[model samples]
Target chain A: MNRSILLQSRPVGMPGPENFEFREGSVQEPQEGQAVIRTLYLSVDPYMRGRMSDAKSYVEPFKLNEVISGGIVGEVVESKSGDLQPGDKVIGMLGWRLYNTVDAGSVRKLDPSIAPLSAYLSVLGLTGLTAYFGLLDIGKPKAGETVVVSGAAGSVGMFVGQIAKIQGTRVVGIAGTDEKCEYLTRELGFDAAVNYKADNFQEELAAACPNGVDVYFDNVGGSVSDAVMNLLNDYARIPLCGAISSYNSTEDVGPRILSKLIKTRSMIKGFVLSDYASRQAEGMQQLGQWLAEGKLKYEETIVEGFDHVVDAFLQLFQGTNLGKMLVKVSDPQA
Target chain B: MNRSILLQSRPVGMPGPENFEFREGSVQEPQEGQAVIRTLYLSVDPYMRGRMSDAKSYVEPFKLNEVISGGIVGEVVESKSGDLQPGDKVIGMLGWRLYNTVDAGSVRKLDPSIAPLSAYLSVLGLTGLTAYFGLLDIGKPKAGETVVVSGAAGSVGMFVGQIAKIQGTRVVGIAGTDEKCEYLTRELGFDAAVNYKADNFQEELAAACPNGVDVYFDNVGGSVSDAVMNLLNDYARIPLCGAISSYNSTEDVGPRILSKLIKTRSMIKGFVLSDYASRQAEGMQQLGQWLAEGKLKYEETIVEGFDHVVDAFLQLFQGTNLGKMLVKVSDPQA
Candidate 1:
């Protein structure tokens, strides 16, 4: 029996676990040119929150009684296609289900010997690709330039800070708690980290970045973004990866320092990882090399059951996850 | 004797004639390394409106009891420095005064034989330089692309359309009156012109731009900019030269389509002509060549006297001037 969570209702503010309903169903036999995979690790992202609402956005909202789809790393249990063999591991945009039967072309074979299979859902996956393109393409960090990133403890933010450091630029991160801030500076090798929950967040951000921010990788918008914008240097670049702060807001509350963009001749560009789909292979190769060099570190807060997928997703909004939030649907077969 | 209007008080909205007080004073002789020039044409631009207020902006606000300075075209009457001789036409940043003394290095010698002396204050001056850099550098219009400009009949907007046309792109303009719109399309060779006052502005704008706007030279930032922003194609560039629409606003009201920038990967860059000071000579040489070739046509709405300079400046906010607004401080010395 395969278990899947279906969208039962649309969410208004933060989505509750009740919005999704788990149902058990029989796994069908794979057709020709298709492979059946048992889910191992399912990725949860902040953008999915936008997809849960019925509002108009870049992607369509999840339909009622349909399985929500995102990135997944799983092992091939059976294959009707010549490209894959039974027990082979692969990664692709697979939905939240215990088992999935998808077209062979939709999946890419993963090398488990190079790294752990779950690494495909973190450092070598969409999270790493997003940080690479968003920083290099949009942020355009130069050597000696100061880079500031919000949500520094999260999946994308962690990679963004480390990438800037690799580019020989000063990296300052803004996280929610003292522990996450410490983790960012100590484990991730960020130059400085500030706790946004601190009473003097703005002052701390300023003191940390005395030279002013040249590139701001904005993951969380609202007050945090507003503070960073005030500290932007002239001709600064902002790659707006996400605005998790305002994603749940029912009313539209746009960023306040929009006028500062004019005065400083700065730019704020929104990016989607899918937009760089053509360059995915190039990005992954570089990210994989960095991981192999031990230059990049990744952490995943895994929730241990298939039924707790909704709980893992909801934790993203509350800032409960330390790094990439993943749902470990099942243990790897030995 | 020379007469000059000095700033008296900052007005809330439009500066009435009362806000300026003219003082008749004797013209002082040029000291060592100084030259005396008789002002022929004085520019009245929307930016000067900002200088009249106490608010902080890119440029310093005009202080009370100080002379309001801007671009001026004049003929040297006396030279204390060997760099300039009597009867030499010059262009420089001089105020509303009919006659004044300035250092020789501060002025650029103009060849009146190449084009009219007033041309130095209009097409070959700061107005033309602004359009050149704002459109070409920031807007980055490619051949066959659709370029749109607001305040089309104004100084900067006129050059923006002509330069876009030179790049083999389709050009559209937005102006206030039917006469200005006619001039933009017929004389200036714009493909289309929209009268912002027309009831069917949105519809006319859409019909005029069938290919979608690729570059929007934003001179007026208000509802007009908002309308054009909505019709922008993906990767559109907006050269934010001026926001005359909000220059007089008592309350803070900016462009409404800010979020659209994120969706389309568009860029809105605010530029002050002075910021590109090092490249001013390069811009002038190109603009002068275009004017001499008759490829660029410029018009000036010259107000009769220095006393009406305040009225002429106020007319800019009201959209009364058809092209580059100027104050004829004195008759040319034959």
Candidate 2:
């Protein structure tokens, strides 16, 4: 038996559990050039909120009453392809189900020796690559320049801060909790971390970057972004990655920033990981090198069981997860 | 006696006549390497509003009780330098006074035979160069793409629309009045023109750009910009030149556009003409060629007399100028 989560209905503002449905069905046998993989881990991201809507975006919207799909890591249970065999660990954009019977070509085989299989779904996957291209290619932080990252406790933001630090920049982070703020400075070695939920957020953010912001990696856009915008230096570059703050709000109104941008002669560019698809290998190799050298570190909050997938996804909006948020469906055979 | 206007006080919101004070004084004698220039035409621009307030910006704020300086075309009345002679036409960033005695190198000599002295302060000058760089460098409007420019009847906007047309792109103009709209489409060769003040502005804008906006040259950045932003195509480029709509308003608030930008993977860059100083000659040469070829045309709403400089500058906010606004201080010696 296979249990799969489906988009029950479209969300209006903030999505709730009622918008999703879990259906049980019989597992299918693998066809030629196909592999039946048992799900190990499935990644949930803030950007996924955009996919739930029917609007035209970078990625296609998920169909109603159909199986919802995202980044999933699995172990091959049965294989009809010559390349994939039982016990082989692979990762692909597969459905949220206990068993995913997909074409062997669709999934990339992962070696557990280099790093744990779960790491591929987090630090070494789209999340880390998002941070890599957005920060280096767009933000282009120079040494001794100030780099500010919003959602600095999240997966992409964490990597952005670390990579900026590696580039010899003064890294300032904006998060929601004091605990996350401490973790960013103490664990991630961010030069400064300010809690956005604090009453004195504006004052704290201004104080964090004494030299003014040269590069701003925006994940959560709103008043938080407005504050950072005021501190932009001449020729500042902003890589607009995600607007998690406005994801659930129907009316995302704020102070117009074009005047401020003109005053500083700055640039703000929006991008996604797919924009750098041709440079995937380059990003992965660099991120892996950084991980091996102890220059980069990552954390993941894994929820147990496929039944808790929706709960895990919902928790992302609440800012409960420290880093990458994933759900463990089953353990790989030893 | 030389007449000059001084910044009497900084404006709180919209500037009034009381903010300026006119005074009379004797003209200074020319020193070594200096030439006394009789002011012919002085430019009144929207960007001057920013200088009126004591805000730290790309240009310094106007000093209280000091002469407000800007782009001025004048005639040399007396010279102490071999480079300049009496009756030679020149242009420079000079004080708003009848006679300015300054260093010869401070002003660039202009030949009246090449083009009218007043043209040097309009089409063949900074206004035209601003449109050239902002449209080509940042906007990057390609042939067959749709280019939309706000404030399309203004000095820079007129050049922008015409240049986009020259690039073989479909040009759309957004302006305040129907007369301006007609002038843009009929007189300036714009493919389409929509009055932003019309009741069904959004509908009209959508109808105007069937292919969607590929390049948006934003000059008025408030609700009018919000309308155009919704019609952006993938990889759209926005060259933010000004925010005239919000220039006087204390709170420049509107819908947040980072989410829309992310959906299209677009870029919005705020730039001043000075950013492309190295390529000034190239821009000027191209503009001159276009004007010579009759592909580009310009208009100046010259308010005669130095006393009306304040009124002319204030009229910019009212959207009264058809193109560049200039104060005709005195006619060049025939």
Query: Best-fitting candidate, measured by TM-score?
Result: 2
Q: Go through the candidates in order and give the C-alpha RMSD of each one to the true structure.
A: 3.7, 0.9
Against the true structure, whose DockQ is highest? 2
Q: TM-score of model 2's chain A, to 2 decimals?
A: 0.99
Worst 10 residues of 2 chain B by lDDT: B111-120
The deviation in Å at residue A46 for candidate 1 is 2.3
**Per-residue C-alpha lDDT of model 2 across residues B1-334, encoded as one tens digit per residue:** 8989999999988999999999999999888999999999999999999999988788999999999999999999999999998989999999999999999999999978877788998898888999999999999999999999999999999999999999999999999999999999889999999999899999999999999999999999999999999999999999999998877888888999999999899999999999999999999889989988999989889899988999999999999899999989898784
TM-score of chain A of each: 0.97, 0.99
User: All candidates' TM-scores?
Assistant: 0.87, 0.99
Colliding pairs, model 2? none
Residue-level lDDT tens digits of model 2 in A76-110: 99999999989999999999999999999999999
For all candidates in order, the CA lDDT equals 0.86, 0.94
